[model samples]
Target chain A: MSDDKLERTERALDFSGIQAPEELLRMKRATPARIGIGHVGARYKTAAALRFGADHAAANDAAFSEVPEDIPARLGFFSVQTLCRDKAEMITRPDLGRYFDEEQKARILSSCRYAPDVQIYCGDGLCAPSIAANIPDLYPAIRDELVFRGISVGTPFFVRYCRVNTARVIGPLLNAEVVCVLIGERPGLLTSESMSAYIAYRPHPDMQENAYTVVSNISRFGTPPVEAAAYIASLIGEILEKKKSGLSLKQNEE
Target chain B: MKDVLMSAGIDIGTTTTQVIFSRLTIAEKGGFGAAPGYAVTRRDVFYRGRVHFTPLLPDDSIDKEEVARILSEEFESAGLRPDDMDTGAVIITGETLKRANAKEVAESIAALSGRFVVTTAGPHLESVLAGKGSGAAELSTRTGKLVANVDIGGGTSNLCFFDDGAVLDTACLDLGGRGIRIENHKIAQIFPGTKRILEAESIRLSVGDSADLPSVRERIENLADVMARLLAEALLLLPESPTLRKVVTNRLITCDRIPEIVTLSGGVADLLGNLPEDPFRYGDIGAFLGASIARNGAIRERLNRNTKETLRATVIGAGNESLTLSGGTVFYQEIAFPLRDLPVVTLPMDGANPEAYGEAIGRAWERIREDGETTAAFASEGLSAPTYEEICRLADAAAKAARQKDPSGSQTWVFVFATDMGKAFGQAFRRRMPPKTSILAMDSVRCGDEDRIDCGDPIGRGDVIPVVVKTLLFDNGERETI
Candidate 1:
């Protein structure tokens, strides 16, 4: 690396004007927040402004981009599309992203197994790169852990222009006891590659928001994909034992 | 919202021995459902014992029996027993560790002092502890300035540099108050190390010399000048002078940056900056030397002088300042809940070269084997939020390196983290390892390359573990650097 790049990476966020810079540094290390970046009078310093702009652009790109075709094919899983036709339509119509189109639904029903113990799927929610970056590590870990516990998982697949609620749509179709969707998170300035796992036990169309439990920020700069995968698998085990998810499962755990 | 524990600190120094008792309140700081983060919310010293002369035998070895008696008496007077202390340390400091029976004495005291008291001695550890007790650590954190603490006890002057509450470097010199012994207002004997200072100045002062003589005062002033000059050179990171080289105990001074402030602690510190007119009050040249230090122009101009304790810094640090709380998001086996005195081997994980993990771990394992140590804790600073593939690669490398060292898999593999990803990393590592292999992982324990750690059982239902990280030199090979 160039000396300037090395120096920039090593240097901590400058909070010289603050009375307690160590406190600010400690807080900054705890999270990936844009705090402690000292301002230049009325605005952020030039470097800080440039970094913010770059992150924002990356987030925009993640939200509008399409999931690559080779990722799912390489994993031996076929892909299906939601009712939304394109990225613009997916953004405009939230309901269309939640459910598959008539033809795509028929393809999923014919290709996937029925009444499995667990069903896993991937989605390009708001950031397709999140799935492309995280799933290779996450999917295998979750699959292996569940298999080790003797839980049968259904034929996993991918959903294009997917939403968090897509797990609810697929759960009843596959007749699975548990459904989990690993989808891209809505991008933020701190990170555009962050992903989230939304899980529900015996999800149905009439299920309330509390029926689903989410573990978010699965990225290189967030929870770490391998660790998050293990955590999600453990949560799935608990959900199977208790036959519940979200608020009820959390309360029972306490 | 906090759990309280009783602690005790005992310091056995060259000239004096003392004990202190304190209370530490540990509490969780993060919001509900957040990853576990616990800290020592409050530390309060409840009792401070009287300073007693270190009992010595006729052979110049520490009198272990007398020392134990004094400690028992003090504990009784304080209305506490050895079982009452939850955790603490009994540290032998200064030149006392050089005594023929120092280790035996230390071990005996550690056994009799408390339920979980640790015995430690070394210049670097002493320097850091003294700095913490003298308030230099706190001052550095508050002011964001580098502060050097010089703790001049009876046998050695230990210098520890602190930046933002962390120890950066350490050095030790054979400079102290009790180097010259006096009796009946006359010089009874001068230690061999102190004799070098007199000879360097071309002043011939020997046993039976009158303490009231002008030559004695001049020798004391010269000693003070040597100490001040040593500090000046250390701040500039220069090689030691010929005079300083003769009295140097440890040559390690790793920090390149000069300190903005300097603090004085230990026995002779009370006399500095404001010397008593009666110089012979202690029957030695300690008062005179303190006065010389106060009058030293270079030290006064270059560094700001500040201090919180004199003669009690090491004891206070041992009793109250040594304990740290680990983060709650940890993974460990129930059987290995409390592990002590494990040497910390920090793995180089700069992430610049992805292929170096196996090689780096192999090199570290070789060093651990060379040291004849079977169990060690591997530590790293930046394992936070790594990609899944990266974590798997690291786990694979770690497992392979560990297996190479002990193919039987009988040893416990402990991983220490400086970041908040211990739970995640531990889970990932466990998924890759055999079920029979024991794994213990903890986070938020900041340790240096040369430090050793003692892990206590988790507190209550929280996942936080009580840890004491220290640098101790028990063997001759480790004594090369303080």
Candidate 2:
């Protein structure tokens, strides 16, 4: 698989007119911290703390916001919940997480717009904090990319413990060429704010193991939230046009 | 003269022990002396240690001696004696066999009884038995064929792979029913009836920190989950071989069908009540084995398909060595059969018993000894029995430490070493994780860090024991290109 650079031509906007001193940029630059345990001692915690701050910003900033007003209006998409009562119920009862819960099912039935080229979802997943942090800028970036490509992203929703394969659970629920689920991964002591996106070609429950793709470690310390969102949108486009996600899809086939 | 011989066999295993007794008449040829004394009884035995009846420590102090003596006394009370004249065998297993001078103890017992013989079947014996009795036999009989068996016992499990009947590879583990019992405290807590029985018998079942009722139930369910996945991996190993199958204690449970029958002989099996009919349709094996010899083939086929030769599996297969086994005697041609080559498709596990426990145990014993060796054959390589909770603790501790170091969930991966190990631990972990997340396992696995060493750069220095989660992502520029 070749990691070829895609075309990018950035024109700097004239932010100089808005006026923030260039010296202020240098005054308080963010630094990442590192932490270590057992015999490693406390020296690493500084780096860890710094990293945590950056990760939190990336997760919580507007760049990663997944608020309601953003979709449908700008990207021609809507959102729904996994039909579960709440996060606590979803954790206690995974079967409910597998399907839409009563109220959630009804909400989706009434609110979700029908028949789009693809459907996208955001799940609190195992690491909801991470998803919340990344959604601000990431969601808009992905939506803009899809809209630019003239691809209609159908009603999207959030999931909990929403496995990569949970996309399959919603595949039949929404008829589309592809489904992308941006969910929280299990938390880690280093940073509980990491998120992952699992994209499947068909999104059927019976899909093969290799039928999905993942973009993990999407916090600031890992991949930048906006870059991850852009990549996810690109992946959705690939799945729609080439019809593939995981190992089976050749790295450069498309 | 319609004289019937009633005999029982007790096989004490690492994870669980079982006692089976049956009554069968030997057809007399020519003229018989003393009319065979109104029923010549030949009792077969395959037993495992139990939390209630057997001591937990690896040492053989008063408990070992008491167990042996109690068994002898019980037999005497059941109208069995040296003078009664016939054949009988006993398997002194696991830690009991590790006692200092354990073999001497067995020899002494054998000499004293005259009618009774003592033997030891190590961890490998079960695989050897499965090879002869299940799909291993078929794999052996066929040229250019491979087969595997994943046997889940109470305290340990076995993964035996074979080319034809010859053993290509074998792995044993400490994970089994005992692990399940300990890891899943909920099984005990949920079934207070079982706890009451244990309490009445003065058995202190240490379920660790999980003493609450809900946690106890969760653990039992976890055990079931582990059992199912481990069963799947064992079956997967024998891919393309129609014969390779997994074997449980009393009945054959295949992946294709729901469990139908189970024989409640061991400590865990005895406590089961109101199991689902959809899954356990055949009921109890103890009840089924007693009715006729018909049920033997179903389980036998399941066991024989993986052997180098499709031979009958039993401890008696050891009798093929021509040594006078500690147990009963078997005439030639009874078990001296050649192996077959072919995959043995499996039926799901079955656990149902409507007959008396005594009769059930007796019947299983008859099937065992009638085939000769008076034991179930298994593979030895890596076989050791540890509790399920112990395994989970090990995995959890390792996974947690790894996570702490690599919070991004990168630079490491958790690879289940043994198929059985993966299933056991994955079952427990799934209950705690998101539903879609599955435990990753190696194609052919091991127990300790040896697999990691073999993996080398794939798993660097920080790699933990029993888990080697990888972190390599292949990124190809297809999305933008498309």
**Count of clashing residue pairs in every prediction:** 1, 146
TM-score of chain A as modeled in candidate 2: 0.65
Superposed by TM-score, candidate 2 places the C-alpha of residue B478 at a distance from the truth, in angstroms, of 55
DockQ values for all predictions?
A: 0.23, 0.00
TM-score of each: 0.80, 0.27
Score candidate 1 by TM-score against the native.
Answer: 0.80
Residues B1-482 of candidate 2: C-alpha lDDT, one tens digit per residue: 22333333444554333333344343332131110112123323332212234444444332556556655665565556544433344454443444555555456556654434345544454444434334444443343344555444444444455543555544444334444233232322212222332344343444353534545434334334333333433344222221112222222323342111211112222223333432212221211112111123332234332122121223233212101111011101112111111111111111122122223323433453464422221101111222333434543543453344334433322332221133233333323333333223221232221001112111111111111111111122111000
What are the Cα lDDT values of the candidates? Answer: 0.77, 0.40
Whole-model alpha-carbon lDDT for candidate 2: 0.40
Q: What is the C-alpha RMSD of each candidate to the true structure, in Å?
A: 5.3, 30.4
